[model samples]
Target chain A: MKVPCAIVGSGNIGTDLMYKLRRSPVLDLVLVAGIDPASDGLRRARGLGIEATVRGIEPILEDPASYPIVFEATSAWVHRQNAPRLEEAGARVVDLTPAKLGPLVVPPVNLDVHLGAPNVNLITCGGQATVPIVAAVARVAPVPYAEIVSTVASRSAGPGTRQNIDEFTKTTSSALAEVGGADTGKAIMILNPAEPPILMRNTVFCALGEGYDADAVAGSIVAMVDEVAAYVPGYRLKADPVFERDTYTTPGGTVPARVVVLLEVEGAGDYFPPYAGNLDIMTASAVRVGESLARELWRAAGLSERDGARDGARDGARA
Target chain B: MSASGKTGEGGRPAFRLTDSTLRDGSHAVAHRFTREQVRTVVAALDRAGVPVIEVTHGDGLGGSSFNYGFSATDEMELVREAVATATRAKIAVLMLPGIGVKEDINRVAEVGATVARIATHCTEADISEQHIKLAKSLGMEAVGFLMMAHMIEPGRLLEQARLMESYGADCVYVVDSAGAMTIDDARRRVAALRAGLSIQVGLHAHNNLSLAVANSLAALEEGADQLDGCTTGLGAGAGNCPTELLVAVCAKSGIETGIDPLRMMDAAEEAVRPIRPDQGVIDRDAIVLGYAGVYGSFLLHSKRAAERYGVDAKDILLELGRRKMVGGQEDMIIDVALELARERAG
Candidate 1:
């Protein structure tokens, strides 16, 4: 029994998420909602035979129990307005915006902790790409400072991304500290306009505390990249993480050792082009979180995994 | 030349001057501008009839970080000092969209910064909309700054500038951040903006190709309403157009700038020259910055990386230019240098 899921705001992100949800085994995409009647995303969803609405989140609100999960792919401002209403309707929200209405979840790092959360905030594209690596290093040794620079192609940045550039930096930075286990964090984003738009690139810099084992840090980072790649197939390290004894001056004091990780994310070409890895990683992570939430819901209702699969097979046979 | 005859009251050219010694010059000095230096410079520029004085980190607000070098004194402290010292000049601050945020704008506004020059890469003006609107909402004059303007053609640049204008930018600038534009490059861009934009058009030139003043003259001939300069040309790369020289030239060319050239010269020599003894010379690395079409702020960082990695700084610059690196990608300097070193070893 795949739980029903809906996506709000049929913009670039929402449209992309629609394509990714088609491949999910545990979640069924029921609705694609947007306020604009002439939205291409809603039209595309309808063409795919999926129910889409022009009434925004009202369709999900009218029959809230039908949608056990909803992905909010709208702007931060719009998500803030829709979050409380969605919660009142008892729908689990996987917020793709930087609204930060609930606990932040980077799937590999803290999805288990926030499994029962009513709303799980995927911080930003930059946060999703770099936080796991920061968490990996933090797991090996204390991270005094972590900074990230996310450069994406200009063509991939729609109006929503452009408007939330500030939120992207702030939310990503805080997630680096709170979820990535850094004492202080900073984030920078760049919109590169090179012709034949460049792939999404991120550089993660972490200042390590004293007595850090280099081998342990490297092993942890490689393992984390594999775990993230299990969902985001195109996510990979550009090269080995560079470890050096470099000095970093933070607001607190100087940090002795540093680790630099370079990452490139190529989209799976679900809806957008391959250069839009920034969007791909977000939707992929949201799907992973939604599936986890669905399993949790089944458990809470006293149904085992084998029983749910048997019921899904029986329902398929009936159809 | 006929456009040079356009004048405001008192027979002065209808042009405003913004001195950037305290802001862009920070990059040349490694972001080590003390509060006293800001005070002295702001006081001198204010007394010399400079209409505006911009003070901030070279990379703008929230720029003090591990990627970009940290400021010696807090940028807010420097902003406060500049605001307190300036009596006649309106204080301005630079806010790159991705490097800085709305909170940075609010903080600068609270400290009496009346003008917010919101900057972005030449092709990415769409990202400046929110910040520009925020600045205008805070009752600050928002200027759209297009850095590295040579990377795009005039028609496309006009389209980007139009986005800023629609977002409530009071003025827009044609910034040669890499000091790479020729005189015609500067002219066509300023002409395109002046012809297209209803808002004011400004030109910011760097002297890497030895064309900062020539390009400023071309912009003036094309009806540019504003021009930026640094006292003694103390800025990144080959520095900016020297304020003292620009004023003296304007005074001699029968163009009225409403600025006392002698006072400006006094400010440059007495206030700014002592800070950097060999300021603004178009040396080899500075020339390479223009030749490679790389960012001006990358000059110092590239040199440091080259020295540490035992590779050529010019090679690092050319590679960065080849990669089409933008303003906020300063972290790539070390990455590029490391790759070059590895290649050399291999």
Candidate 2:
């Protein structure tokens, strides 16, 4: 028996998930609903012989029996309005909006809880990157305050992100609340207006409570970052550098971050590098976390159960 | 009646604090600040007891005329507008001679400025004569701004300071435009400015070294009479001594800065809102650019070059920096070539 799944909003993520879904033996690639028929993702899905339609997105969410599971990958505002309707109809919703309507999920960390939910909110690319660091930091320190500076090439953030920029604070906090606890959290987001946008990058500054050695804290941060990065493919620390004060330049001409590590020790410069590296590591982790949540939900939607029967066919491509 | 106290000669704080944001920060965003923002900033500075503000760009028209420096607004309008708004703060305007010498001095006075600064690169200052003399003739308080104080020899800077003083300038500013100078370097430059000239000495610090406060404090300790700052350290690359840091440090050290150092928080929040990048900010790149002895604006160029070349932005920056590329110098290879020519001549 095929576990039927519908792909909603055939954008980049929706299409990629569609391709992955078609390859699964247990899941029926039932219908692809796109707001824009001309979107390249829908075109590609149509070419692959997957059922595709546009504009009347309601058809997929009209009844749960039509498609047992729905992947909501539209703009933030769109997802905020669409996710509830899909969930109410009894189809479990996997939302890809950066909006915080329900819970934000970074799979490997929050998989146990969200996998059982009727509706799950996936963190934004930035949230996916930083949530793990929040988890890692909470493991070692009594965090009183945390601040994140997330800079991305303007191009990397979509229109949904821009519209929900302010809510990024609430959305990120909700994700962090699930795993990494902080007394107070602050995020400063920047979008570079560069004509040809650069890759997404972020920097985090965290202040742990009393009796904490910021340097040791920074070390713990690096280890935890390494843990999360391991889960995040294509994300690696660009530099393992000893940053000097205010000179964030590395030996390889990479900008060595300027930092003044504040410890109870007063004017200490020791904790800056590991702290800097951890920020980068955590930020990349956030992107992977978002993707991981999407994959996990689809698997639990019973595709894996069906994949088992056709194991011989998928075994060759399992890797 | 003094805003802070009795205005009996030398009673309120010797020199007023001036935020050179629109002027120096213009180096970062190409002086994109609107007239309305400028007016608000001047009002905020006025409320803070900042008595002098430099409205710049030599008729606001300098930058690379046929090339790529910050082309300022019309000198008269830029100065007059600020002067009209901040009646208490002396309206001061800056002009880079030869860049705007012919059109500036008389127009600066016409625009209602009370003080005019004549700017020149110490590496090439002989050509600034006509502009400096014109400011003096107009009876405006004349100032000579010598940029990139590190790139030029100390002795040469002293000579230039002496020349500006002799040419009837009221003050000489040692601008560590790169924010690269150490406290020691700042002290030496300030001392040199003071020792060689009868006019007051000033320091315009950048945060490239993250030492704007340290350097400015050193200059003051060494007897420099004037200092420059900004709202939220929001100028070019890394920004300058945060106006708050300067005031706070000065207050903590017993120097009389009539402005409330705390008001800086208000200023910082106001000025940095529009300019901050999305996502990661005031982070590693800022710290690195500070250490490299340059402004943050250059990073935009490096980032551009990196994206275009599909290589590392940091590599692009180092290559540009090895040649001493100034932040506002977009066609900077030419400036590097000029430096080469000067080195050969020397």
Enumerate the candidates' DockQ scores in order: 0.66, 0.01
Error of 2 at B318 (Å): 2.0
| Residue B279 local lDDT, model 2 | 13
Deviation of model 1 at B35, angstroms: 1.0
Q: Candidate 1: deviation at residue A167, Å? A: 1.7
TM-score (C-alpha) between model 1 and the true structure: 0.93
* Candidate RMSDs in order: 2.6, 19.5
Q: Chain A alone, model 2, TM-score?
A: 0.69
Candidate 1 regions exceeding 4 Å error are: A35-37, A55-65, A244-247, A306-319, B1-14
Question: Residue-wise lDDT of candidate 1 within A1-319, one digit each (tens)?
Answer: 8778999989888999999887776777889999898899999999999998989889889999999899999978999999999999999999998889999999999999999889999999999999999999999898888999999999988887787788889889999999999998989999999988889999998887778899999999999999999999999988788876756666646877788898999999988999999999999999999989988888888989877767755654543
* Predicted structure 2: lDDT: 0.58
lDDT of 2 by residue, B155-256 (tens): 889997887777777788898866678888887888777777777888888776678888887777666777888767767667777787778766776667
